[model samples]
Target: MEHLFGVMLVWLLAAVWIFLLVSWAITGDVSAVEAAFGSVVALLLAIASAQRAFPYVVPFSLATLGGGAVALPVLRAYLNRAAHAQMDAELIERACLAYEFDPKNYGALINLAEVCYKNGLLEQAVRHLEHAIQQAPVMAANEKRRLRMWQDELQHHPKLGYTPCMHCGARSSVGAVRCERCRHLLLPLLVHGRWVPRQLVHKAVAVWGIAVGASALSLLWREQLTGLNALVAILATLSVALGLIVWVVRR
Candidate 1:
């Protein structure tokens, strides 16, 4: 409901901006300064409304802008993958919530575990898998075997911080800085408290590349571009860049 209201408000502000712009363009009576001011105010209002209505879009767009010097296709593929991951997470969460209404739904628990594993929530995934395994006796023999196999694999998965020692190939305990078998220093895997994935930082670099490239092209063809066209390009680029920053912080 709130999202719908925000979208409607944005459209209203956008319509007003268009009317003011058109009126100024056609009427010689309206001062350029006054028209520009009104346009700026309307644009800001519209952007605010958009943020409220489509919060994720803004951040994703901005992160794309920040992806400086990255190839367009690569950056796009990364974002697409991340978006899919997020969608899967949401779906799994919804399924888990639904399963809560019926605690006997072992399938939902397994699905939730798989999704959590893919999303790097290793500990949570392990817990879900264990729960599903406990409920496995009621399931078929093959199903029990499959669940056990998954649980075994997850128990040794490196992302859970139980990585193999470089020197002796023995697995180290979680948060272990050294290999217990060989006394070798293990590689540190630090998981920071980040709202957004580190991948967003890489995407932001590509975005910066696009912004710079566009600006350079505009400057090179300045004689072919009008003042309004140049202004629009600048504003569009800035908006995208800003949106990526918003996504990074909010995510």
Candidate 2:
């Protein structure tokens, strides 16, 4: 056991030395190598002073430790860069697809526009957003307001070739519903004056809020009712009940 401890300590010291050597090679500074060597010596002294420190980690082999010390940084950097590139590509593709499928999907358009603007594709982003506004349902007053703002801004800004009406190929506001030339509707008109039954939305929201609040309250006090086990069970049951209420109201 003492021999094993001696060998393991030697291996650890070697690993620390290897790390310092790599750092010295990268930075090419005499002071950096000296600092790293001092840190490793301090670490070794601390380990030698602690009798129980080496025993727990005895089963790991020296070769395994050495290879791991070298491989870890290389593997980590490769994985990180690969993941970042994949995410960026996916986000851009999703943004493009969203605009193509539903030009009026304003949330997606906004996300795409933001990305484009950040990356210096401002004109393309504006074109996408303008097209989104034009296609969005005009019945929603908020949507109309959004479209009006973008249109008002675009008119003052550098004019790109007008986005032709999707239906009639005539130059018009991206928000234009009916084509002036063909008389065909390019997008659904928002029903601004149409009445929604206020009672239905109000009742649904009220019931949902009450059920959720009751579930949260029950979860907080469940410990007194039956202890940890019962608390977990009751919390699970109440959460399910709350979810059911949400689903029903949404439907």
Candidate 3:
């Protein structure tokens, strides 16, 4: 209900913006600044509302925003089609067939996951998600996080006879003795019917500690780091530190 309301509000704002722009262009009554400001606000509102409606459509970035703007006419024409694509069984089956033919296609895997999940095919959904995650090494962190969250949610639906890798969290077939990503030994499910790798847990704790410490230091010394040069230096140092830590953890 709230999403519907937001979409309606966005359309209303967009309509007003278009009316104002057209009126200004025709009569030359409204100031340029006013038109520009109104247009910007309307665009922002529309993007926000569209995100609520279609979270997986685009990443939130300036480049994506510009691309979305350029594609706005097409998007508006087929908005309903794009939004409800997953609900079409025929389309989903076609996507699944395509994925089977080319298992490495990350986009097809993700689409299959979504459609399967929506259709209550929990096991298939989980499998597709895991495959997508494994193949998407270069995917953005935010996108990977979203996929992980979805996989985690589906894990609780029912037993799929698969165990998650303790090191990289990828699901492994049951009775497997090693994780595919990190080659870490999978212990017997002696506790809680699941194996929890202590090394992985310790590494996670160390990473969290470093992140918290860095954030605390940044907050405490924010006033002193006033100049652009200082900001750049800090960012560079932190980036290097983070890169090293990630390399070590992945190794």
By TM-score, who's the top model here?
1
Full-model lDDT, candidate 3: 0.54
Model 1, CA-based lDDT: 0.53
lDDT values, one for every candidate? 0.53, 0.49, 0.54
Give a tens-digit lDDT track for model 1, residues 120-205: 65655666666666776666476567556666876777554564555677887643435688875433111112134535555454
Give each model a TM-score: 0.39, 0.26, 0.29
Candidate 3 has what TM-score?
0.29
Q: Number of clashing pairs, model 2?
A: 5
What would the per-residue lDDT of candidate 3 be over residues 17-119, giving only the tens digit for each residue?
5565556546544346545644654565466556542332222222333433444444333433433442354556556566657878888777766765665
User: Total clashing residue pairs per candidate?
Assistant: 17, 5, 0
User: Lowest-lDDT window of 10 residues in candidate 1?
Assistant: 186-195
Q: Tell me the TM-score of model 2.
A: 0.26
Error of 2 at 245 (Å): 65
Which candidate would rank higher by TM-score, 1 or 2? 1
Give the Cα-based TM-score of candidate 1 against the true structure: 0.39
- The segments of candidate 1 whose C-alpha lies over 4 angstroms from its true place after superposition are 1-70, 158-251
